[model samples]
Target: MEEETDTEEEKLLKRQRRERKELQAKIQGMKNAVPKNDKKRRKQLTEDVARLEAEMDERHQQEVEHLRLEISKQVEVESLANGIGKLECEDGEKTAQHSRPTKAQKRRDKKAALEKEREERIAEAEIENLSGVRHLENQKLGHVLAGRGLQIKQIPSDGHCMYRAVEDQLKERGSMLTLAQLRSQTAQYMQGHVDDFLPFLITPSTGDVYTPEEFEKYCDDIVNTPAWGGQLELRALSHILQTPIEVVQADSSPIVVGEEYSSKPVILVYMRHAYGLGEHYNSVEELKDRTTEIG
Candidate 1:
């Protein structure tokens, strides 16, 4: 029975590890699809990873607790039987002393202690890896831009960074669209094509699909408020402008939205941690000279 229980515990741990590995692979795929410099996306991913780990740990704890209880009951039964035999042999004059822990119990306790230590080490290593990735991405962004003879043109960290970056790109192409105009047009486009955009609109508080009314309010926020723009807004802008929008980030190749609209693409740099605030976008301009410092 002890060996059988040990085998079950080992199987449970292996299954847990496999599930975690699959989840991490899925998260990495998501990271690849989007810009790595998206602070919000990275934060969301981190939270998801942490949540998953916590859940797995909780489940393992519960299972171990259950197993411990079963073992304790078995030990009590065996000790009771042994006590009866000793009492009978001594003709009821003496009682049985408490039994020492079995070899199997000692081995199980040691294994559990070692497993906990391993988990703690793994968690610490994961935290360090996340920090290292953030630092490496910052350095890689500079190298990526320099290789292309382009440099980041800083945009204000206001909620309108995406629009402002687009505005800067439009100006270079002799288009005089202000950020306000871009915001308004993007909102209007999304409103007119509700079928296309409404499905993607989610109510953050409920984590549910947005109702038509909620979707309208979202569009209103886009036009009137300083709500940050993201992939959805980028898609609307790309369609409205009839141009492809290319987003360059540190850890991945450029992500181009609306490629079918035009061969020429307006480019923007995505910074994960450039400003201390959060995710941000900036315009890219040609390097004045090789001597120009990469910001």
Candidate 2:
């Protein structure tokens, strides 16, 4: 009986897995058929995919419940076959003859424990996969840029990476500005335009708006310390230099800042895992010839 029950459970699980694989393949095909630029179609595709995934999850839950019920019925039958019964005492109270857990109960407990362990392993793997995904994205960005006759000129992994990349691009345009000078100018520009940048400056730890004094200190750090630069600083730099800046990434189209300033924008590549030291930026330069070897 136990062997028959095991065979049935295995068959059901195998069939469900096969169905899930086919559904996933169909969804992927649907996504591949849609063009990336068609925002409406892509949005609709996203909704459809989400709906399908939810349905699959619900179906999987139902199958699990069904299997649990089947196991419970089998356990009850096995217990009855083992002569499980109750005895009446002198006080007319009934007491179970068996004091220890039955074999079927132990099997059910073991299965539940194994399922919980598998879930925990999956959760841990997902956390590790975040970094893995970023690494893969950086590689994809390299391939995309290579196809466009451009290559990433790696910048140092220091906190001044953004400024350094900007400085490198500016040099190609005949603007000889030191990293320190660029930092100072960016800091000064933000300090002068507090109303523009302050609204976005929320304290990460407290999740509150920064006081005027805090904002001032932030600007000061941009100049005097190795503070990291972000989108706000990029905007400020674009305006200060009076040149449009383009940030390219793997997952999306290039983002143009200060587009009003110039038609020819300075290109910078944003990377998540290129340097292994957190978010970094690299300068983009055109290849000299079509025959140039690319890695």
- Candidate number of the best TM-score: 1
Clashing pairs in 1: none
lDDT of 1 at 241: 88
Please report, in order, the local distance difference test score of every candidate based on alpha carbons.
Answer: 0.74, 0.75
Per-model TM-score versus the true fold: 0.55, 0.54
lDDT of 2 by residue, 206-260 (tens): 6477899999898899899777677778889999988899989887787777989
Query: Which candidate should be chosen as best, given lDDT against the real structure?
Result: 2
Kindly provide the TM-score of model 1 when superposed on the true structure, using C-alpha atoms: 0.55
lDDT of 1 at 1: 18
- lDDT, model 2, position 145: 82
Pairs that clash in candidate 2: none
Over the stretch 110-180, how does candidate 1's per-residue lDDT look in tens digits? 99899868766755665566567667776787678887888788899766888999999999999989989
State the displacement of the C-alpha of residue 203, model 1, in Å, after optimal TM-score superposition.
2.3
